[model samples]
Every structure is written in structure tokens, then in C-alpha cells.
Target: MILFDQIIFGPIHSRRLGLSLGVNLLPIDAKICSFNCIYCECGFNTTMHDSPIPTRDQVRETLDAKLHEMVAEGQIPDVITFAGNGEPTLHAEFEGIIDDTIALRNKYCPTAKVSVLSNSTRIHKPHIFAALNKVDNNILKFDSAIDRTMKLMDQPVGKHINVAWFIEHLKKFDGRLIIQTMFLRGEVQGEKLDNTTDEEVEAWIQALEQIRPQQVMMYSLDREAPTQNLQKVSVDELNIIAEKVRAKGFDVSVAG
Candidate 1:
């Protein structure tokens, strides 16, 4: 039920990425996402709204000004993040925007990293993959490795998508990407769901082994979920899962 109302909204402290400055390429007044996740902080996708996606030029200009301003205030962000009301990759000019953001970050605060939070739905697209590779931290969502659990959790808008499809494209990263997983328990549409079960965790670990990411980020709901029945996984539980991932000889970061 929360929405960011600006193109350049936050330099807020992020649990995973510190001092994060956000860029919202989607409409400021409404959400535009490929997945209508029950636990999305922005709530369900908005079907109707007049707000337009910002032009490439507009994003460049605004981001440039904001970065310049932050530099002047001696508040250099740790990362320039492409995340907000909805899926940032959905923007037609996403690649060009990443190009612009990189230039601005270099000019204003060269040390700051550039990151994007994506749902991993568009990684197969040539342009999106290229753009993602250019960023410092290409964090992607992989909430569950099981087909049924994933469908119930992510609620992807694309009917053709399945766990098989995700594993296939994700391996394309070739260990260059960061896999982000959210662990939680709840019931949605009258079915019990929990991605933390032994079987679920085991399946997810197997998937991660194949994906071979450079690192893994694990966390639970830090904010209220739209689905009222959802429960947050305890920090201890998260650390346990993180340890399992660590045993696989992969770098893991926990943000609970």
C-alpha cells in the first residue's frame, strides 16, 4: 500500500545497499510491474493511471541534477539504485537510462555503485541483460525454486513463466549476478505457503548451485505485506538458511 511519488525519491538507508539513492522510471503516481506479488511493499499493480513513463532525456536531466545536488551537500550515496514503484526494467528506455545514470554517477560521485532490483523476469532479453551487467550490483529476485511455490508467491503476470524458465535464463548470468531471495510464510487465495520448509530450501539451494551467482542476498519482510496473513521469518531462521547457502561455497549476505 506504499508508493514513492517522485522520480528521484530516496537516499534512504537500505539494509542490503547502504545509503541508496532511488530512481523510479515508471509512473510516479501508479505502479507498473510484471508481477503482482502479494508481499510487494508497493501493494498490487495499478491497472489504470494517467501518469506517463519519464522520457530518457527527462531521467538523465533529473538524475544529473540530483546527483549534482547530493555531491554539493557532501552526501554521496553508496549506490544509485534503479528501483521504486514497480519494475524498473519495464521502462522502454531502461538501457539508455542506465547509461545516463552511470555517466552522472561518474561525474558526481565516482565511488558510488549503481544497482538495480529486478524480479528476474526479463533477464533473457538482450538489452535488459546487457544493461544489468553494466551495473555494480545486479540484484534479482528468486523467492522460491519450486514451480508451485513460485507461482503462488510471485504471482507473475506471464502465464508461460515457470521455475524451469527461470533456472534456464538465470544460468545465463554465468555467475555474474546476485540472487536475492525472500523467505516468508503465509496463505494466499486460501492455500498455505511457506518457502522456508526443508524441501523448499533444499530445492532453492539446488537451483542456486546451477545459477552459480557471485553472491546471494537473503531477507524477510521488513515492511507490512499486502497479504495480511503473511508472517516474517525470524532473523535466526534467516541466518540458518544463509548458512545452508554458505555451505554450498557461495557468498551469502543476510539482511534481517
Candidate 2:
């Protein structure tokens, strides 16, 4: 079953961060986010709505208990990850949750790092950025570099958020900005889908130069996606893309 079928999973394994213990900040049915990407493994949000946000105390208690249990059982996760059924930042009490989780992680697993898997939509928020900076890994999503293409692929809530603005704002962040991109080709709403084109990749590469992220996390779909037409880029293709990005002087990791 998909990991989110439960509130938490892993310390299982990760290509980038080893032995990650997941922390699901979103409630069971409150999997809300700004994007409706076709490749999301949780499938598209069924409600198309945001929620009565989960409490910070609730997340802290659950996470603290889990950490304690793992410690007691001699299970030491490498990272305490803020990733779950939906974007962790959407939880209104996100900053508090991050603070609480970090404290608990230090108390139980001092060697472990705290990380987040975010969409970068909330990067503009001062509070969110402050919390993100505290994490060991800030895995932010930037699926496409072209505005029109991004709108179709990510389907974000605010129309004003575009590639240029994203790059400009990302400059404010002090910590390592781990860019996570999904390379795929698939049909959405009866149209052909392809981000594998030379033009698209070139745009992404150029944008990457401006952002100058610490590293790039490139991967393709491996789980059931919202649309059937979406196709994963092969390992050879992923490696080729990584090589090109590396040529420009940035480290890249192939997750798939």
C-alpha cells in the first residue's frame, strides 16, 4: 500500500536521506494543498478545498510518541521528515509543528536531521521560510520552468505565481534549496503532456542557473498517477538530464 495509507511510514529507506521517519502534519481527510499536479501519488485532491487545519499540539503529540517508541525499540531514523498526504505547510500551525518536531528529534535522535518536502508555494510567507531554513533538507518542487506549462502541470491555486517570480523569491531563502522535479509526459484534459522536450528542458536549465539551488532531485513517476497517459522518463534519460544539469555546475540526484 502507498505509505500515506497510514499516518506515518518509514525509516524504511530513501535515496537522498537515509532511514527517514515520516511525520504527517495533515489529518486523514484534510490532505489539502495549492497544486493539483497530475503526477501526485496521493491522487488529485478529491475535495478541491482546504480545511479546518490540524492542531499543532495534535501533530506534536503524535510525532513525539512515535519518536519515543522508535527510540525504545532501538530504531534510530536518519531524518524526521515533514512529508505526508499533502503539503505540510498548509497546516496553519506549520511553524509550531516544525519547532516541536525539531525539539523532539533532538531529544530522541540528536544525530538525525529534520527535513521537509514542500511545493514552494508558501516560500513567500516569512513564517514559512523561517521554519524551512531550520530544516536540514528543503526539498521544494518546481516541475516546469515555463509559465503556461507550469500552470498546466502544477495547477496551482493562485494564477499570479509564475516561474520568474518563483526564482526571484527563492533568492530570499538562505538554506540549501533542494529542487525536486518530476520529468514526465502524459495527457491531461485531452491534451498531450510532455516536459521532455528540448525547449522545456532548456528553460528549466536556464531558470536553475538563476536559482542556483544547492542540489537537484530529479525523478519520474513510479506509483499510480492521476492520469493514465503520464509516462516516466527512463533511467538513461534521467541520467542524461542530470549530466547536463551537472555540466552547469550543480549537483543532481536521480531518485527513481
Candidate 2 lDDT over 15-44, as tens digits, reads: 778898887776565456788777787777
Model 1: how far residue 42 lies from native, Å: 0.2
Which regions of candidate 2 deviate over 4 angstroms? 1-7, 48-53
lDDT of 1 at 90: 94
In model 1, the runs with Cα more than 4 Å from the true position are: none
RMSD of candidate 1 to the true fold? Answer: 0.7
lDDT of 1 by residue, 1-256 (tens): 8898889988899999999999999887898899988899998899887888889999899888888888899999999999999999999989989998998888999999999999989888899999999999999999999988998988999887899999999999888899999888989899999999999999999999999999999999999788889999999999998899899999999987
Deviation from native of the Cα of residue 6 in model 2, angstroms:
4.9
Q: Cα lDDT for residue 46, model 2? A: 56
Displacement of the residue 124 alpha carbon in candidate 1, Å = 1.3
Residue 19 in model 2: shift from native, Å? 1.5
In model 1, where is the ten-residue run with the lowest total lDDT? Answer: 1-10
